[model samples]
Target: MPLRSLLRTIPIEPSPEGEKGGLQRRMGTIPLMMLGIGATVGTGVFFVMHEAVPAAGPATVLAFLLAALAAGLSALCYAEMASAVPASGSTYTYAYATLGELAAVIVAACLLLEYGVSTAAVAVGWSGYLNLLLDNTVGVSFPAILSANPWDSTPGILNLPAVLLVLLCALLLIRGVSESAKVNTAMVVIKVAVLVLFGAVAFTGFQADNFADFAPFGAAGVTAAAGTIFFTFIGLDAVSTAGGEAKDPRRSLPRAILGALAVVTALYLFVAVAAIGSQPWQAFSDPEQQSVGLAVIIENITGAAWPGTLLALGAVISIFSVTLVVMYGQTRVLYSMGRDGLVPGFFARVNQRTGTPVNTTIVVAVAVGLLAAFVPLGGLWDLVSIGTLVAFIVVAVSVLVLRRKRPDLPRGFRVPFGPVIPVLSIITCLVVLSGLGLVTYAWFGAWVGAALLYYALWGRKSAARARARD
Candidate 1:
């Protein structure tokens, strides 16, 4: 037998109770779609436009399209895996069943940075907008000392709101506060409506000059900007992760994943196009316009505050919920790793009181909160792109491996073109990975190195390997 197959011989099966933990299967197709939108449409749509537009100029629309294409391909692969192996472990569990224990460990490590750090980044970004909303609408603002990060361009002592928000979400999750399918469907509707409103209002100020100097740095710039813009597309996998709770795993999972992808991509492209036409792309870099780029265009177009205020208010509400869902995903991924004995068992301990993993939630919440409080979102964005790039690459490869190893395994959703699709998916992910900056690679290396060292010295050696051997 192959060495990889030998590793699989060990039966480190999960305890049936923890396996069937009361985490209800209440998420259906509609709720799953909402979760995807909730997790995805937050900081990326509201905040990333300012950063991405200047890089790609009016071609920001094309950048959104390209990112969605790549994300769509990956999402299709994810749908197949999720339906084939319905579970809560996300990509880590999928990798374990199809690959081996070692590959699962590496994928889990990638996810730690992908989901955990992204949670910190989104929460921190949300804090900035929340502050903006308070100052403009409520006439209340926290001092710079408490509202900004100490390490920011204009340093503040701490970011109090960001920290508090993380804690709030943690408390909610511990009580098993899940968004019902109906509620999720409603949120998706609200999110779509708000973005459409922003696009319509912003389009009234459309100007032709913004297209001048399109692709300022040529294709390289578009690719680089896409790397940044890719964060907007991260939660497309929100479709796959809901497989266990989906109504018709085969039909609904694929349609929901593809439908959400199509809708989000169209909306994002519309926003990008509308924003570019509303102003000179260079104006995107103006600091005053960064927080509410679309809103600023509305203010300029209609010469009114109501539209801007409304957009900002929508952002504050929607982004808060996005932070909650994404942070919840991060905690659950860690919980799965902990349960597998690849990390501290403390992370897997479910609270008897609420029947949720309270301690783990707190640990993840505090760490992410501190990062959000002290580090600016700019510092966190590149790392999020890199971590996600690596994880997606792994999933793409896993799809191909599973096809060859277990051809008879039933897959509810299969990628078209067989090996060709998986191969293209892997290549596309790597191409995007290459576009990432040197600093992103450095940060990614440090994170992966840390996880591997922990695994080598502790997790791999002291993990359930010992239990399985005995």
Candidate 2:
């Protein structure tokens, strides 16, 4: 095939229309928004505070705001794409429609990092909190070999709890979307309530002194912290992927995307303020406390075990839901690619009875489960952040491309500031991307290169055959 043919664009039809077999539209605005919140509010809130606080001191609050600003801008672009495209592939589908097959393939690679690795990262965090809960409630915990990554300060043979959590969520996902959404809603409630309770209890011990040395490491630290905190906001785009299953997607997609972002940003800022106020920022660096930072802060404030224990319990439960939702996103994106013939047919095969992609879900489960079992949380998070930022950049660019290329297309939601919003979205994502180190970029480049190679040799031929057959 010629390069131009390989880079041909897909029409902007809904996934069901293009593929014939489609996902059920069982999700409304509430469940759609809940999925976003369920995926977004987990590891970042539960685990990132420890890393961010140490990086920026009390100014980590500012880091949260910075991250939210970038995420909000990208989400606006996502809302527009979701409204116009209304497909299951998220940014990949949008890219295929606006950019081309090459861009879509690249976006698929980025999303693999965003959703697949993120599931691993969230599960790792869940393992830590689960250990905290176990130590508090049962007076016992898994040994380092079973619970910690080999490279962690307290090295373990493998992270068993994280692997177990991934498998459990995978099982739940196989049950179906409505069941997953219901579980997600319940987990979101539990996690949000726990954060609210933490804020209320921690505020009692608030001290103004914690703010005196804010930004101790300077603006560089704040920027770097924002990059790390960006991990927490990664799931806001999960709303866009539900376009295929979203009821009244035109209206519900935008509302859910922006609504979930607003809720998550507010909660994050509130929790950051309460956490820094309740304890000195310098103490967040303690390795013993970092794994269960928020819970430890609550324990310090109340001088009791129960409040912290409850928070740990909430983290464990909620992060499990996060892993589930992210893994779901991964499968659906692969399903889209599979349908388009960019991957093997197994990925797009929806289970006849359940209306879900069971094979894709299983593939995602095994891959994510292995990463969770072996990779350290800190490194996993940085990789997720880089992929998310790049994918957001592409979404922002797609908004601009689609507007110029096909103005006749009816859009359910449009960015209020027109091109200015998308331009800023691109700039903000680039700014955050700059904070990631050279090593991360190298890893990302290697991954993308490998993916492109796979496409050149196998995916291109398969996709061309599929197109010719059609």
Candidate 3:
């Protein structure tokens, strides 16, 4: 293929709703907000502080703020592009429409880790929390063979709960957007209230001394901790994936993205403050505290078992929504690529009864379930972070390119201060990307290499065939 051909950009026309291969516009501002929250607030809130508190000390709250800022900047760019283009695929569609096919495919490659691997990882994590909740509430839990995979540290037959969780999410998704959004909204509400409950209970035991030695690691430590904390904001991009189905996307896309970010950031800070005040800062670094989480801190304060049980319930719900939204995002991205003939056409085929991409949802669910059931992806999380940062950079770059190339594009919301925010978004992402180890870069390189090879062997030819048929 000629370089010029690979550089060809997509036309601005988006398919109309309810048409073949097009999603229905049933997502209002509230459902979109719930989707964003559902994706963004996951098991991280339950466990991140144990790792972050050691580095930033009591100033881990500052690290949360810094991480949110990076996520916020990229989100602003996503809003602009989503409003301008109004499509299902997040960065892939934005990149194709602005930066061309080559850039779009590269973004698609990154998304495999961000959405695909992240979904499976969250599912596996959810399985552990499910057993924990069972053991807490009842006397018995699932046997080890059913709870873990053969390759895991403690080997087992398969991760049955993880696969079942993926199936339930897939069923909800296949039923249509309205049903999935409702379940996601309900899950988000439950998890949020659970955390709030923990905060309220933990505040009863607040100690003023915990804040005395704030920032024990100083500025460099805060910066390093921000890098560690940033990936918790990964689910924010899931909001942009629903652009094609958003009700009045020009207005709702920006609001939902910004709204979700605000809620997630405030929640993290609130929980961090409450957890730190409940016990000494140094206690968070203890190995036992890592697994017991905020629940343990509450248990220590209230001398009750119910709060820990409640938190375990929240942990299960937290990962469930994350898995659902991440899986949704992955399918929609593949839907866009499928429509463009970069992959199989069935991925883009919409079911008339449900008005959803049935084949795409099923295929994505099965793939994710298999990965969740047998593969251990917990150690490869840095790959998820790498992919997310790269995708955000692409989004920011797309905003810059579109502003220059299509200045008159009808964007519902624009990034404030012209190019400064978009440029800063790129620079901020690069700084976070720098924190990744060399091993991450090597893995990312190999991942991209495989994706490009697939494109070379079949993707371009497939697209050509589709265009000729049209």
TM-score preference between candidates 2 and 3, better one: 3
lDDT of 1 by residue, 96-155 (tens): 777777777777777777777777776776676777778888899777788789888778
Name model 1 segments beyond 4 Å from true. Answer: 1-18, 47-59, 153-155, 180-187, 203-228, 242-252, 276-291, 351-355, 375-377, 465-470
Task: Return the top candidate by TM-score.
Answer: 3
| Model 3 CA deviation exceeding 4 Å by range | 15-21
Name the runs in model 2 displaced over 4 angstroms.
Answer: 15-19, 47-60, 143-145, 148-158, 207-225, 279-292, 374-380
Candidate 3 scores a C-alpha RMSD against the true structure in Å of: 1.4
Candidate 1 has a TM-score of: 0.86
RMSD of every candidate to native, in Å, equals 3.8, 2.8, 1.4
Residue-wise C-alpha lDDT for candidate 2, range 1-470, written one tens digit per residue:
58797569887866433235657788889999998998888755766889999999999999999988888898999999998998899999998998888898899999998888777877887887888889989899988889988888989899999889988888888898999999999989988998898889989999999899988999989988988887678788988877788888888999999999999999999999998998888899999888666878878777887877887787787788788788888888998898889999878888877888899888899998888888765765577778888899999999999999988888889999779999999988787777779999899999999999999899988988877876
TM-score of each: 0.86, 0.91, 0.97
Whole-model lDDT values for every prediction: 0.73, 0.86, 0.89
The alpha-carbon lDDT assigned to residue 302 of candidate 1 equals: 86
Name the weakest run of 10 consecutive residues (lDDT summed) in model 1.
9-18
Given candidate 1, what's the lDDT at residue 110? 77
